[model samples]
Target chain A: MSILLNKDSRIIVQGFTGSAGSFHAGKCIEYGSQIVGGVTPGRGGTTHLDRPVFNTVEEAVKKTAANVSLIFVPAPAAADSVMEAGKAGISLIICITEGIPVLDMAKAKQFLKTHAPQARLIGPNCPGVITPDECKAGIMPGYIHKKGPIGLVSRSGTLTYEAVHQLSQKGLGQSTVVGIGGDPIPGSSFVDILDLFERDPQTEAIVMIGEIGGSAEEDAAAFYKARMKKPLFIFIAGKSAPPGRRMGHAGAIVEGSAGTHASKIEALKSAGATVIENLSEIGSTVARNFKPVVA
Target chain B: MKLLEYEGKEIFRSLKVPLPEFGGVIDKPAQINSILKRLKKGPWVLKAQVLAGGRGKAGGVKLAKTPAEARAFAKAMIGMKMATHQTHGQTLKVEQVLVEQGVKIEKEFYFSVAIDRKIGSPVVIASSQGGVEIETLAAEHPEQIIKKPLDPVFGLLPFAARALAFELGVPAGHIASFSQVATTLVKLFIDKDMSLLEVNPLVLTPKGFVALDAKIVTDDNALFRHTDFSKRVDIEASPAEREAKKHDISYVGLDGNIGCMVNGAGLAMGTMDTIALAGGSPANFLDVGGAANQERVERAFKIILKDPKVKTILVNIFGGIVRCDMIAEGILAVLKKMKLQVPLVVRLEGTNSEKGREILDRSGTRLITASSLWEAAQKSVAATGGKI
Candidate 1:
């Protein structure tokens, strides 16, 4: 009942011959994801992890009927891989590659808009998404996630893992955990994932982890205020970060007063979402805010 | 990376954009004569080459009516210390000065092309209320700024540029030249993989529109394609930050006592926030990145130890793609090789965390181990004599 991915999802690994693609694709398979085939431009007709490899995404899709494409291409070619997947009619594309230029992503966004409007691109610099025990399509540690009712979305990788770890420790498992990435121009937004989480019947409550960045968090706050019906808890990191310096992530920069932590926290609080100040307080706050949903 | 004014102008010139005649860079007072010979005539502008913005108001820019005045200004500016609001009050050393022919401005217009993250496209922002403060213009006269989002596929079309120019109050006679400037700027932005290309006060002189000031920031990630431009990266970063950059790690120097090293940028920042929440300030922010192998961990440790203000070091890592035991080994190797004067707090989680903990415990080093981020922050803060 999770959104975007589940047991029926047939995934194909793009850049399958690379070290990162093969390694993580094998791990995803170990966690019960349906990885049917792979795509590597010149390495077609070869096989990796006992799956057939094709030259292009179109060939892979046609041969194996792959519904989703997981990208592990390097930064220089990652955007083209995304465009290739979208043009090939792959509905869901999860890009795990980091360091893609912002201009390339800008072009890819436009390309997707005109070429494949139905395709949903998750991240160009993220850990991808997972539907708990049913399927995994990212670099997240598989053991930490458990199939349950809570939905989680974040702009971070390990921070999402931290939230999931705390939630699992508190006996609250997840329905789906989506890492929308920390890039300045991500394919999906907080509002986009929030809309999906709200529609998923299995998701009871949601936890959003955001940081100092663009107005995505503020926009999400506005969306929640206007349309959301379920309870949501949020944690915005980088409160102690100095202004003007990029705090690790490319998108996590405090330019003037636009992306400051104070403004984001204020926006979320005024939108009726309980914003936790400390990272360790996320679990306790979420637990206190929501009562158990009876089956 | 942020390019100096001269470097940005050189890029614009290469792309055939109209700019003020160059008088060359004056690295020393003696070079002023050579620069003056290259210029057309009198009335030159001496601009200090510093990475910080708002140089005009900070007196980093000066106008000289004669060659002697230009030489004197260059001598005064070179080897001087200047501070700007962008630099957060930190004084930057001016190593070079740019001497250029000053233009008679009939009008000033603000024009910039930058990747708009909100719209997921490249946007060209223009305003007739040019050279005054762009931030103030944006804040007060939002309507005065006309923004046009450019299509990456076909780029900014002539009609679109004409519309933007017309809306920006470009004179009917000057719209064609303005459109040419806009089209060239957009092409430069795309071809150069620039994150930002700004021409503040694109002046309209008797000769037509000329770029009076230029600021171009190339994307560091896309530097692979621009090999020649990558060599021009500014040397304004701190030594430790420069070293981290060499190793492909992210490091930002801070004024605190606890040196925090973590994997993943978001988690690194979260670790810093947690350290502050535990009543301790962080000396710096260092992200060893996702693949924290032994070499990277060792390099990160060296960078952290280079800061003399650090009294305690906290290594908080959540191993997802990175193995925890490998990081533990790297730490042990660093401790064995170097004479560490500060207390070290190591917290490892995720893959092979138990093995990582066992390795650290068996190393017989004087190190504090924590099972969680909170515990690690508390230990590091207490070790640094801070209340938790």
Candidate 2:
């Protein structure tokens, strides 16, 4: 079974009237997501892509019995959407929007600690999650994904696609793929997805694509060292990026002390995971490292 | 984007943080007299405001004893382009001359609070040996650097700041002063939504602590909150980069001419390296994202065409979420709108891949689709008829 989403999981879309929300929600629906309804504030009671719209998340949840909420609100309102979804008793809140202020995320994180401690947050700026061959959510290209044993997760959007393409070329399909996004203060970390992959029976091995930012990679390394059942092949981006130049990813910057490509790579290497620097090397690195027994 | 010292000082001043008196910006030779009238002090610092490092050694910062010398210094800086590590060309950003009484440096100390990606909290780094490069100091005198991790939940507390200050060996009474600066810096950093806030050479003056130089780099993603500072960005950046931004393509100008265009940042960088490895130089690093429309394609092509050195255009798109036909449409649109002259090579894969190639092949703008990245680079280099 997939971790966050599956065919039976009912979901609601926040800010579904917006272009990104509608476009992705339509695609998710086409891929057989159980989109019970949508919430677009003033556009409530209306319908988007044949799903009923509500003004507030609470109202949508009460009516639709939606267990998960996918938020596609703009940057400024993304944190509020997360809080709203959490307060509405939705267990899983996936934020697909990018660029929410870190301060906002900090405040929202505090709120989540008290209000919705049981709820799981996939991202505040992530591409959300997809249980391959089960259910799809977020804006990932749906065509390249196929059901397999490898669990793929990344901090980048298109880079994940690139990794999946290479994996597909190698005849390695995916169990699920999650884009954790590039925001400075993302809700979920690599370890969170790693735990999910470890528990999922279908996910035998994982391909984690991290970038040059944050200590999340190190945290994931710590997790790997402590007790990860599956073999993991990881690729960290922005190795050649100059110090102080924030790579295209918002979170990928070498500032103060923690966010650098080298530190992340060193940490992962010491943790017993095979670390591949280049994107092209991810598949080969994984293929060579993973024994058939792991799958 | 990083702001110059003067700009950072202006932001500090706006936040009601105390700073030394400053003079007006002098853009012309004639504006020197007025700048002199604005300065209350005799000895002033003529600092060139360029977005780069090593400005101090480039003769960008100098002490002028007289107003005439300050004016002359301003004149010398005006219209003179100075290159720095952060800048590519001679950046003409010396808008005004800052005339101020230089503070007496009792000791150079460093302090900065930024997002620590490790714990996802604001990390405060303080060192007794400040002013110089912290990296160097950390390597040489590792004991001098003090690392204090801040809790995102509780924020940077006063006790934590004082403890850090005490660890840095400040006296009992001076701990309060250091704590004040630390707290103020943390506030300013969080309030401004800055990605980095560095006070190198935080000097110990007779009056109190004074910031000798401040370096601030804000997160471009959070620029929407600070429109005033956003408007002040240097518009003189490479034309292609600016144009790519307009169409939402992540583009950075490099000194090459293969005009490599790819669909992802990782793929784009990989493509750039593959080109370089294949003896072809990439003109720029352009990531059109996984969703490339005709408008973005036309914009990418226009930006590529703007580079006269671009002899061949290499378009490599792994069409998964983004279809190949859409990429082909964008390429054709760019070719048609720009009236195509450069030889173009493309490698399109995934999602209606063959149909996309058919569209490009039928376009007749000298398009060639290679089977792999190596083939695409070889074809692009061959099409250029020389090493790019």
Candidate 3:
């Protein structure tokens, strides 16, 4: 009943031979992700973690029938990897590489919108997504996640873990956790995942995390206030972060048109979602919002 | 990052944008005095060259009537630290101050084209109310701001530029000039690989349109293409920021005592948030950026240790793309290399995490291992004697 990924989803690893790619792919496999194969140019015929590798993503997809691709390429070529995956008909692509050029993403987004509108991409610099207790994608750890009804989505990875661990400690498990990536431009938005979470019957409530960048939260706020039927607990990080500096996330900047922590917090609060300013408060907030089930 | 008024003027001049006449960058106070003496055009503007905004309000910009006064102003600014809305008032090299003729503003207007997250395109925002805070304008008089998203393929069409210009109450005759500037701005944005090009108070002079102030921030990730533009980027950034760039850690310094380290930026910020929630301030936001190899981790640790204010070190690695044992090796490396006796709290969650904990447990580094972020923050705060 979770969204995006489950046991049946076939995954492909882009840049599978590189240090980050090979390492995370191995971990994803260990976490029960159906990693069909991998793609690393010039490393064709080589097997990593006993998965067959191909020179191109198109060739890998053709042979392995992989539907989703998680990329770990470095910044410079990261855009091309996403584009290649999109062109190869990979329905869901998650890019875990950070520091991708904004212009590159601008063009990539443009190309994605036009060429493959159905091809969903996650990040060029993001933590990816995890459908807890079933499959893990990107760079998130699998041990901390447990499957339940609460859907967790965030822009920060470690903060996601912090929140998840807290909820897990409180006996509140998650249905899915998606890191939309903290890049200035990401593949999916809060609303995109919210729609999925709303449809998943197992997900009774949601925990959404946002940072100070872009008006995505405001847009999400408007959507939630107008039509969101589920109980949503939210946290917006970087409330005290100074303006202009990129902080840790490529998208976490408080500058002109972006990053007024007050604005994001106020907007989310107005949107009817309980806003938790501190990471430690997310679990308790969600626990209070969601009624306990009696056996 | 913000370019100083003079540096902004340089970018403006390169774009063939009209501005008050200015000469080259001059460092020595005597050079500024000579330049002031040679100009002899009544009172001139002494603008400091820095990478921060709101310099005018910070007294970074001053008008001097005499060459001696200009020299005094230059001298005062040379070794002086100036803080602005965008900076911490760190002292710059005072390489050269621009001596330029001051413009009498008949009208002030705001014009900028930045990437709009909502529209997912570069949006041109224009307002007739210039020189005033755009946020205030947006808040109080929302109608004055005109936003038009530019297509990445075709860019800002002349019609869209004209529309924004017309909405700014630009005269019919000046619309052509403003449109040209707007089109050129789009070109400059694409060519220079800039994320933002702001000209607040694009004043209406008796002569024509002149950019009184310019704020241009190029996309750092696009620096590989804009090699020449990269050369002009402010090299006087904080030592930790500069060092982080070398090791690929996206570290930003803060005024706190706990030196925090995390593998992802969101996590790093969350750790900072958790520390603050626990009543401890984080000294820096260091994201080792998924590279938890010993070399990168040691480099990050060294950079964190450079901050004399950091009383304790908090290392939280989720170990997604990076293994935890490798992180352990890095902590040991930092412990051995710097011999840091500061209180250390380490939290590892992910692949080979137990091995990572084992390495730290046996390293003889006397580091605290927290099972969770809560315990880690408490340990870090306690290590700082609970003040931070």
Please tell me which predicted candidate would have the highest lDDT against the true structure: 1
TM-score of each: 0.97, 0.88, 0.90
Q: Give the poorly placed runs of model 1, Cα more than 4 Å off.
A: B37-40, B386-388
Q: Alpha-carbon error at A198 in model 2, in Å?
A: 3.1
Q: B1-388 in candidate 2: lDDT tens per residue?
A: 7787888888777765556666655557686677677665678777776666667766788888887787778778776667664453445556555556666667778888776655566778889898677777888898888878765556678988888877887767677777787788888887777767888878777666777777887767677888977787444356667667767888877677889778877667667766775677888778887568887777777777788888889988887668888888877776766767777889987777899989988876677789677688888888888533
lDDT of 1 by residue, A1-295 (tens): 9989999999999988799999999999999999999999998998989999999999999999998999999999999999999999999999999999888999898889999897999997899999988999999999999888889999999999988988887788899999999998999999999999999999999999999978999999999999998889999989888888887778999876688899999999999998888887777787777875842
| Best first by DockQ, ranked | 1, 3, 2
Give the per-residue lDDT digits (tens) of candidate 2, residues A118-165. 788887666678887778878877877877788998887777887887
Off by over 4 Å in 2: A239-243, A254-272, A275-295, B27-43, B57-59, B63-97, B149-181, B277-279, B381-388
Please report how far candidate 2 places residue B86 from its true position, in Å. 6.2
Model 1 chain A worst lDDT run, 10 consecutive residues:
A286-295
Model 1 chain B lowest lDDT segment of ten = B229-238
The true-versus-predicted C-alpha distance at residue A111 of model 2, in Å, is 3.0
Give the C-alpha interface root-mean-square deviation per candidate.
Answer: 1.1, 3.1, 2.1
**Native RMSD of candidate 3 (Å):** 3.2
Comparing 2 and 3 by lDDT, which wins?
3
Clash list (residue pairs), candidate 2? A141-B321, A215-B117, B25-B96, B26-B96, B26-B97, B131-B201, B256-B283
Q: Kindly give the stretch of ten consecutive residues in candidate 2 chain A with the minimal lDDT sum.
A: A239-248
* Weakest ten-residue segment in model 2 chain B by summed lDDT: B84-93
**DockQ, Cα level, model 1:** 0.79
User: Residues B259-300, candidate 3, lDDT per residue (tens digit)?
Assistant: 988877777877888898888889998888765688887888
